[model samples]
Target: MKSRKTRVLAVLLVLSLLGAACSKSSDTKEKKKTEDTDYEKHSMETKESTEETTTETTEPSQRDTSVRPVSTPTPTPEPIPMLTAADIQSMNNNNALIVYNEVGNVSTIVGRFFHRPVADEDDAINAIKGVQELLGLQTGYFPFAVYGERFQGYTVYTYQQMKEDVTVTNATLKIVLDQEGYPCMLQSSLASNLDYTPSSPTITEKDAEEIVLNNMGSGYRVLSEYTMTTVYTDYAKAQHCYQVYTNSLIDNASFDMPYIVHFISLDGEYINAYPTAFLPTDPFADYGQDSYFKDMVPTDYSFTINVNGNQVDITIPISKNNVDGKYYLCDPDRKIIVADYYSFEFKGQLKFDTQDDPNSFDAAHMVNYYYYTQAYDFYKEFNIESTDGFGMPILILDGYCDESGRAIKNCCNMGIQYGWSVFAATDGYSFGHSLDLVGHEYTHGVTFYSKQGVQYYNEYGAINEAYSDIMGNIMEMYMGETSDTEWAIGERSGDECRSMSYPYKHYQPMYVGDLYYISTSPLSYLSGLDDKGGVHDNSSLLSHMCYYLYMNGMSLEDLTWFFLASIEMQTPNADYDDFYAIFVASARMTGHEEIIPLLSDYWESTGLKGPREQTAENTTLEGYERINIPFYSAKVGAYCVVEVYSVALGGRYLYTTMQWDGIATFLAPADGTWFLIGITEFSDASLSTKVSEKWLNHDLTAWTDDPNDLGYIVFESGKITTFPTYQ
Candidate 1:
């Protein structure tokens, strides 16, 4: 019902994290930090399976009063014996369980407990062990937690098939079985024929950490252990006999590097790491090419501006690469590649000019804005120089058509891009209409650039889609949408596409357990456009998780930081688990452990689980306060928009609302006074209001007449002012 269209819209009117009703301390005082906040009853426990995420919670809302409760942890069920290899043979019905399936050269195995009287985890362990013995994987390295609940539902477990723990070139293993003890499938893969050896680590854990830190050159906090029961070695490479585990941090504030791994040699030598920083130096720097026309957006320098008469350097070099041609390519600027698909009109005589094709003219606008906005977000949001943190020029193949368009299918509506560097979009008339959607595509360029590349079919493919959705929605939330917009893709449909808050409302799952099918085939990817390997659809899982975190007080800046910083920790085909483990480690590195509970709760709500896990259950955001900002205009029915931004974790647009009621009420992001302003107008351009005594004339005194009072905000003549209450 919220999909009901609003005739008028407003934008960029913003207030500080705490809305109108809040008053400043007027005196310095420290705030409290929590190892665990009393967030009981607020965690997302969804009551309905059909609920939408944007308007839903993860945990259920109502209790089933009819059900009996004699709480005793259900007596831990009865203890069952761990089975042996011979025990599994007695149960095998000669089913051809799927062997290891290779994904990006990483093999995975699957099995199902198809028999009646279901078996438990112990039985599953015995079955998998026997199966592995049959496949001759005993010599290979299995996961340290072979019996851990790696996957949800039907007693599934996964172990990485490491060719060599040191310089791993290939790894894979996964098994799915039910309680019935029937083996469903088993998968494992490794491409390297390189010999591997298990060795004893001579280097002390403390020494190895120091060696890795010294070789890597800063921006890392190390874990205590060598991260192994025994030393792991990749005999294929020069570096062998090393310790492998995610980097941990005791103090995380200054932590800012991407690689989640450290391959430390047992002999105190440096082998190889998973991701080296993607800080490719700018190649467009002067190598004796100084050709500047007028208004050229520099791909290489910072533009200076006087903010409140204070010189503030903002980096935005307007491009002189705006050439009116069949397709203008930024040559010397190798990082930026703009392929104008075509700009011709069929009006009697053929024309190759963009002016002739009105749509084509719009295309140029869309792509240019794409570059500009993305540059702004990457830099301003995460201090990321460009699409690639290393400042890679965005590659855009634009002017892709709408009605009967030809080119990449997923790139158009689903935001599912296929190629690396190259990004595609229909002119503003088709797909590029939504600024955030275009931002979404270009962000894929960032992710691809960061991942070095991405897979477009499996979970990696799904992650690609999810990242696009996450960034796109953020752009739309804080930067794009005038009013509260649905976390949907493209500019075409209304309330008809994927929903972020309520993915279920749009027929998508918010967790891995809800995946469409366990086994997959090429048909899933090749099945015409939208459902590419269920990439677009299944992506709602991560997207929903992303949105949930944002809703539960995770600022855009932190989310962006969490995302951008966590990139190097991923494989070309990383899944939710990969994200989970790395996120916990990285959050600790950044000293954001307080929010880990929030992140962990959302992750588990979606059926993914991990350690140092924190839970955030904001059923109704109970503890957070609110300010009902009031507004007035000589112009009746003037759309009033408000944005509440939080600076606690760097600046982030935490809440927004647009209405004709001349009022916008919002949950204060923190415990303090909030500032209100309209940074931009409906035209989507900055609406500047100089900061002076006149701007601060609005009332900020809090009403303490009632002990059980929240707060209120009022605006006058376009400036924020206090007014009367409604309650």
Candidate 2:
């Protein structure tokens, strides 16, 4: 286990890699505007150099050819040419896949590519630069941090993306190097362009701080040190904004008071703010007022205690202070401690602290101790040291209260900076009483430590929540007393708060773009405070995919292992498309390739994947310059784009609005000889136009004089005369 200072420094390093643009202070003192200005101008370098580079290649693994055909690549000699988007697209195989985000960004790329192992940060920079030039990777996206790790005898390097010395949320580039240090795969979600202009802000950092403080109301304040200028995409538009990281000053505030990001524009105008904290269950749900207990793992500190309204016999481990000679709710082996919020103490040799059997509220502490240990033991199976991976003591504060002394009626992981405290209200059926809930909260810590810590907002955040619910339910199935409640979350609390199998029953979307599907529009999300951009509501979509496989024959243990192993394979902003690619990669990497077809088919059914080419009908139309292209956007909620290339002009991009009626109207750029290509947008990533080969890579002269040519569309006499059948 690492020391506290070491752990703090490591997390700070991770946060820096996470592109935390500002420094947050634990101090309560108010910061001046001048200090904030200085803070914003400072830049921290995160690159390191090495001396040796590796250049080698090995045989690729077998893949499931039935689902997607595999194509073996012919080895290339030295001095590989730079990669183009089209070149990358052409490289797709059963083992490799490339996914584009909305607005034409290369959101995800998985599979091996030809390259030598980068010896250091400089080599990595050059490697990225070569690809960036071809991919049209825009300015403002620069590497701020690079980290290397050994996996399966291979070297994997991950680079964090920053813009103008500020962190760009969820943008990253990952490069995988094989045993001999040769490039294996490259994955990225960096921004594609600088559509938004960058200029000097009209307001100071202190003014932005005050705006956020005022928005949070009286009891809240900004973590000045954590505050920083950041680049965030609100819906599809990128904005240079100030991220005012704010949280409650109260010691035991409810989970509802999780850390919030108050986004303010350069002009000092408030754009929006939402909870940035990650938890298991829906923080917005109205928790039921009941609690119960199950069989316990008996220990030396045996006691008969009342849990909610029922009596249960349980035993647990606790520690005794050496000097005071009094027992406290602390365990040394598991490195966990429970604190009583009411007395502002750690059950420390005060009021029944030594009592073998405490009652009423005191019993909640015991319940927490028991279930927390249970949760810890479950994670221990996978060999996780603790939430911090440093054997840091797990701290639990029972009976959290607000400023008015009212029970917060919630639980949350207060983050590693706060000593990894998991606080819950002791009123009614406390959140800590249920093993699943405890596991749910504990998994947040696991995610925090995972290789690509999923952000707690937008698409990735939804996935993060789903991960908790999935593991929480899994823990109940394996550890708790046998029962019929297998796919239900918070079942021990009397109300089946959420149903993973039947998500719609609890008003959550079972599939993307369903009845309860929440929009990611910045206007709607910020004004309505819609669960941090619908993370909770949309989480079920991904969770349902996992549960669907589990119910369709995958063993519970295997499902658990796959999901656990896949976490470290993700990037910060990875969405549904990225998950699909990463999951398939994990299955192949972990010898679970048989499940790929099932997973792929399920994703397609849910609209995450699409057919690459839609059959086209050769038709001749009259007197119209617009084409009514049919697209499958119902499940994805995306818009389509058409790229027309002319010999006289390099290429022209055209846009259109998405219609729910399953048709998109694309207008041609005027009467001319043009070659057509198509693209569409999903919530996170985009898809290329489904078209046959007759329309692509053809000589303009082949169709220039021939009206019957199916390869090109001609607009003569103010009307298109030839049209291809489109899907």
Candidate 3:
């Protein structure tokens, strides 16, 4: 039996070896199949490559068959055509539009253009018809052309139908809207004919001249001559002349008496007239009549007239108002008239000797001359006449004019004593001696007149100063003088004037140091200078704030709004806070509500603390809400240290202690959740209240034992809770 088992085992072992051999043989067959497959694929690739090479070799030109070259042709641009005046005129004529060739006739059209632009062809045609209707011309088939290239281009348009339109006439000017709703004007001659109906009078130019000479006297002489031309259908020209004459009664007269009359004629017809005395009407009426010149007469006089185009310049000489007072030759009557005289070249200067009289020519006179010359030049350019005889006076005084001390002191004294609001240099300061000061003083007068009798102080005072300052700057800008607008009032005063841009630049003891605490005790003591009874001191703040706003790009409108609000809303005794509130309210009123948040943010950023309120509450066991405490505390640390005053609902008053330990944990009570507050240092009872109350000790051992656990502890119904210092 043993031998048979051995034989069986041996056979099994042999069979197992045979199976392993068979498995190995199968694996080898698969590997060989994979290698043969790879070899066959490589062979196929090589055969394809060979075919490609054969093809390339057979036809070398075929190798360039990657892509076909594209041929792009250049594009040609279209040309723009030019237009001519004749073409434009022809187009307008075909359109049946009326044309205005004379430039003067286009005045009405230009006025309409200023008011409104043409909307369409209908508007343009209607404008032409309107002009014809005004001129009482036949409403025939009239086409009007508004040559866009001006009258140089003959553009015409026809009005198919008349449209109802309104007409506005001002004096000799007539404006009409055509069927197309555009305005047009009649040529000057036609307009004159329509304006004035001529009777059966055959008046020749020589006859008209004779009539004018008879009426104006033999002393009159023609000054300037001009030819007025107009083009409607054809050009019409008319001769115009300006005549001047010196009246013997008023001629060669001094300031006290009226000067000679000067008459002007247009085409041998009297048009307008005036006298040399017209310019000094105000000064004559005010001072010349009373103390200065009681009985003044003319000694000797002569006249010289220059004529150019439509302008005429007349120079006349006259005696002084009095040997004592100053001499002036002015034309007051013609001041308001828009005469053709573009300018008056007053070449003569008033001579005064300091040796004869000390107050002969003072600084005030020089200043007056400056202002009068300025005002004269201003109106001359615009052909504006001084209707009110409100020409500024020039008083020449002889002496060394100390603009610094005397003028400034005088202004200040006058302003304070008589409420004059004088604007003069501070000591030797001339930079501030400008038109701005004058305007500022005048504005003060106006304000005083309007407001009755209101004294300025606090907010009102600040506003008053600010108003004057702003207006002063504005007046300077209006007069085209900005060079002297720096904060310095009078650098010429050596050291007398106030600095506008930088008050501290003066090194005034009051303005030195931190601006906010300048008024405080220690700082104030350090700077022992009294700020002009606190006026200058407090006013600096206002000026500084205004400067800040100005630098920040506040517009004139914004400044005006702020000023209005400040003056209207401010009380007599308002402080800085009141000023702030008024400013905020005014900003809101003026549709600048966004400024409120910005202002608040600015205050906070400046480290200024504002008002705040706080409250606390507790819940009852019945789950009802109740107000338990009303206490306030500054936000401190990680938790609030609110003091408990009294309990609202009945509960155990256990004084328990708790702590944050190494990690903070929460403890729940029957009513509310209590947090384990942490402390860094400890303090005794008396010291606790004196220092901070957050250092009190309480139980929190569990949290410290396994702080990483981040676990919480629940206090029983009657257990007390207190906070201890963190270990």
**Residue range 1-727, candidate 3, lDDT tens digits:** 0000000000010111000111111221121000000000000000001111110011111212122112211112323223222332343333211223222232112112212334433344333343443323443222211111111011122111111110001111122222223332212112222232223324433444455455544454431111111111111121122223222222110101112222223334443232221111111112221122233433323322211122222222222444555444322222111100001111122232222332232333334223333333433222211211122222212121121212212221011111011122222233223544433433343233222112232223333444554554544454554455565432322223344566666432222112211221111111111221123334444555555565567664455445543333332223343344445544543445555555444334322112100000111222222211111221221222222211333332322111111112221334554323223221211112233333222344321323343322233443323333233
- How well does candidate 2 score on lDDT at residue 694? 25
- By lDDT, rank the candidates, best first: 2, 1, 3
Worst 10 residues of 2 by lDDT: 33-42
lDDT of 1 by residue, 1-727 (tens): 1111111101101110001111112242221100111111111111112332221111111211133212211112444444332343334432221211222221222223223323443344454444443333443433221222211122233332233222232232334443233444433332233334545568766666677665544445543322332222231122244444333221211111122344466676554443211211112122211232222333433344332234534332224335542222332333443445333111112121123222233433433434445534544444444553433334445554322334322232211111113344444333344545556666665665434333454455667777777877777666634244556654331223567778877677665423221112222222212243356676786788777777777787667656654553343544554455445534532335666677767766765442111211111133343444443431221222234433344454543332223443333433444443321122111112222111112343432334234232222221222333211
Best by lDDT: 2
Per residue, candidate 2 scores C-alpha lDDT tens digits across 170-190 of 566666554455454556756
Please give the distance, in angstroms, between residue 438's alpha carbon in candidate 3 and its true position after superposition: 5.0
**Global lDDT of each model?**
0.38, 0.53, 0.27
Candidate 1 C-alpha error for residue 380, in Å: 5.5
User: Sort by TM-score, best first: what order?
Assistant: 2, 1, 3
